[model samples]
Target: MNVLIIGGGGFIGSRLATEWLRQHPESKGKITLVDQAFLDIIKNNPGFECIAGDFSDPSLIDPLLEKKPELIFHLAAVVSGEAEKNFDLGMRVNLYGSQHLLEKCRQLAYCPKVVFASSCGIFGGDVNQVLTEETAPKPKSSYGTQKAMVDLLMNDFSRRGFVDARCLRLPTITVRPGKPNAATSSFLSSIIREPLNGKATSYPVAPSSPFWILSPKQVVRNFIHAAKLSAKDIGDDRTINLPGITVSVQEMIDSLEKVTHKGITDHISYEPDAFLQSIVLTWPPNFDTKKADALGFTADKNTTEIITNYIQEEHIQVPEK
Candidate 1:
């Protein structure tokens, strides 16, 4: 399949490129990756063609659609914190940009498979309720609102025979391997990554605040799996709440302590900030992923396995507990 990854320069997108190529070594297909920038590794890698451009721009994205990539992975977005702070940017990229891409695909008339990276942020301010497939989205943040809107659009487009879309509502991806970005949930990775590297990090929420998390490993696997499913197998809705494990900030700290030496979690601290709390706390914590379960999707075994996988995957030699 001729594949296109919209946010391919980001860590998740880059990793997805590698994993996809690894799985289909015998296939003869072109993979194109577009982003604002690229790491030397990605740009230099012979596995895929890297394009530096903004997907939100019709000038840049239009010509890309001309290539008619058979499999489109729409992973680019403005993320939560930045999206909340800058409504215009979020609306432009997260909402309008996506609509432009969908319209372009509709013009092609060759219904391509689109695997979208939606978020649990779409379900907000209902912490007491366990989010299920039937749960309605009442987003409290602009980021969530944008994603929820796109989910609706993707569903409609798929139902109308414009695109074969699969919208996977992703959990907060954790244990990322670099400096934290503008995401409000960036603390989730910082609390684990920084401490393990012998640096200090702090969170802007309460220790008991719960987050729905999935490891990067599982996210890639599930993304690939989503692309492989037939429309009937995926059902009519075209959206699946990808399974994830829920853990509080305290539990995440505890998981790190379990997998590493004592002082590892000691490097983590809580310095509450109302702004981040307002956005993150509004997100619903728990989910019922029975539909995803039936579709053969999977999540990390546990938070401990999540941290362990990150360590091993990064080749970080840590003193075990």
Candidate 2:
């Protein structure tokens, strides 16, 4: 079975690519990674083909469609903060680009199974109760709005028999390796990974701030599980919130203190940025993932396990202070 991973060079996308190859080694088809950069990273591996270009370009997608992958995992998007800042770019890349891909699948004689990586940000604004699949989405950020819109498109297209589409609404992925970027939630990973490596990190939200988080491994697992789920089982909903651990900022810091021998808690300083705080505060802190659980998707055991697993997976060296 062939697979095409859009935005395959990215953090979660790259990890998903590796997981796919590891799980499907006996398969004959190549795993085509479509991205603008980092093609060199996976280009050499057997059954891996790196195509470097913008998916936003209509001309670029035809060749990809011609290849006729059996499965398409769309994880490409301008993230939360950047999307809110540049609405046009977010619409072009996140909304328009996704619509174009879905349309292409509709045109195909044999539509591929599409796994869309959506965000929990789609369920924005204040809510004391846990969010379930039935909760009506009220997105506060442009990024969230775009994701929700595409989610609807996925459902509509699935109902029309255009494609076997499944949307997994992922939570904020924590303990991510590498340098920080424009994503407002970057600090969630930085606060853990950077300080563990003896580098300073910032927390742009208050200590009491609560949000849902999942490990990189769990995120990849969700992608794989979604791909394997039968269309008959997934049904008309077409979208499901992947399970995650919900914790406050203070709880995260407490986990850091317990995991690392050294006093890494001191390394973190909270100076809330209104823009970042505003976007984050609007997001749901927890989800009622009963549907996801019943469907066989899993979450981390707890925050400590999540942190420890990340440290081990990333091979982050603990500092001697």
Candidate 3:
């Protein structure tokens, strides 16, 4: 019952950890987390084993693999914006780091189950059509290319019985419960999050720009579901385009106003960044998640429910109506 999360310090990774523990109280100390750094809340906790270090380094991952955790959630990666800016860093962490980990697993020969956090950005380049698992990757940015590479590697490893792997092509997760980081899609969260906190924010794309999105809660739920699936369930194709809803930027803003009060989006501006748009604009917003749906993965009901969920989860007091 040993479990390990690679990027345990990040927002989604941390949420997964909290929910994992809550669901499986008996697995208290058996779950471990490896990351470059951690929040005080996660680091100072006595119930979980938090390994604060760069997992890309063989020194870090080597010892971790030695323990042979039965279920490994590989959520670590350089974000889209950061990776697009620094190709070397992206290759190091996103590609090579993962390469070494898989090599170690193959050497160790435990064949543990691995659930990877891949992205929809992998469906770039003239992708106006709905994406499915059979859609070949046409990554335009360095970030997408690197993530796509890892997905291929994991699939190959699984085919060869080196590891039982599932790569979930995650959509842009909305309403993240923190300050936006370097992800090109951070604006998706910022437009909703910053204004909800009575702060100002701007989206770098047009109001009509379409995006595939899911809630943080649903993303974590799918990750857990992926881990429980038997090898026969996944069969040949290990990649699953996780369920998500398609909505335009204007639709999101409209929902924010609906969930809270009017003028919530008034705090948002129209400043645009071509750099961010270049990456996101190329992503295919529509998806046919027949595989994920059949495999028991869930999707968010709508943008309104997503915003409401965030408010409840973060305990954000809204303006009185």
Candidate 4:
């Protein structure tokens, strides 16, 4: 099937494009990747068409959909910390842009299966217990609020037969290959990424502070699984929290030590930023992923596996001291 990936230039988006192509090797249709920019790898692929533009612009989105992409993966967003710091930019891109895309999908002659990349950040503000499919979202950040809104739209749009959609509420994906972005949970990746690159990184929260985390690999798998799933499998609810393992900040560091050397632990330091900590502290550390698990979604085995997988996948070079 012809596929369209919004924000296909970003970390998760780019990886999903690659993995999707790998999984569908004998496919006949071109995979269209729409982003503000594109990676050379995707642009060079013969079976892929890379479109660089703003999805918020109806002009841009309309023409892209007219190309008739039957499967769409929506992974574009302003992210948590950036959205909180700049409300207008966040609303325009995260909220308004999402609505515009949905409207375009409604206008399409054929319904497309949309796999939206939502966030567990949607659940925050005194989330002290394990969050489940039934947990109500009490979003504290503008980013979280926007994601929760999109989750609603995904459900309603699917219910209305506008688009066959599945909103996967992804956790903080760790060991991202590139430099950190504005997302507050970025530090979670930074702690492992930088130390491996021989640079020091700081943890913005307490050592005991836990996070529901998936690896980049698992997140991509979830995206594909969501897209390939039948409407009957998802039922009426188009949104579900994807499976992830919860690990503390200290536990992540410990994993780094296990994967690399004990000396790698020295590369990490704690210097809590209250703003970051407040946003993080509000998110539930654990989740009951039984629903997602039963639905065929999966999580990482553990933190050590998370680290080792990153190293192998990224081909990271462990610096010699």
* Candidate that would win on lDDT: 1
lDDT preference between candidates 1 and 2, better one: 1
- What RMSD does model 2 have? 1.2
Best model per TM-score? 3
Candidate 3 residue runs with Cα over 4 Å from true position = none
1-321 per-residue lDDT for model 1 (tens digits): 789999999989999988998898743248899999999988887778899989999999888888989899999999999999999999999999999999999999599999999998898876999999789999889999999999999999999999999999999999899899999899999999988888889999989888999999999999999999999998889889999998999998988888887777766778989999888998888999999999999999999999999999999877444
Q: Cα RMSDs of all predictions?
A: 1.3, 1.2, 1.0, 1.2
Candidate 1, residue 153: Cα displacement in angstroms equals 0.5
- In the range 192-292, model 4's lDDT, one tens digit per residue, is 99999889889988899889999999999889888878999889988899999989999999888888888876868899799998798888978988878
TM-score of each candidate structure, all chains considered together: 0.97, 0.97, 0.98, 0.97
lDDT of 2 by residue, 271-318 (tens): 879999888888888789999999999889888998899889988788
Give the whole-model CA lDDT for all candidates, comma-separated: 0.91, 0.88, 0.90, 0.89
> Which tens-of-lDDT digit does each residue in 1-321 have in candidate 3?
888999987888888988898898888988899998889888876657999888899988899888879999999999999998988999999999999989988886578999999999898876579788888899978889988999999999999999999999999999887888999999999988898788888988889999999999999999989988999999987989999999999999999899888877787888889898889999999889998999999999999999999999999988554
Q: Please say which candidate is ahead in lDDT: 3 or 4.
A: 3
CA lDDT for candidate 2: 0.88
- Kindly provide the TM-score of model 2 when superposed on the true structure, using C-alpha atoms: 0.97
| Residue range with the least summed lDDT across 10 consecutive positions in model 2 | 38-47
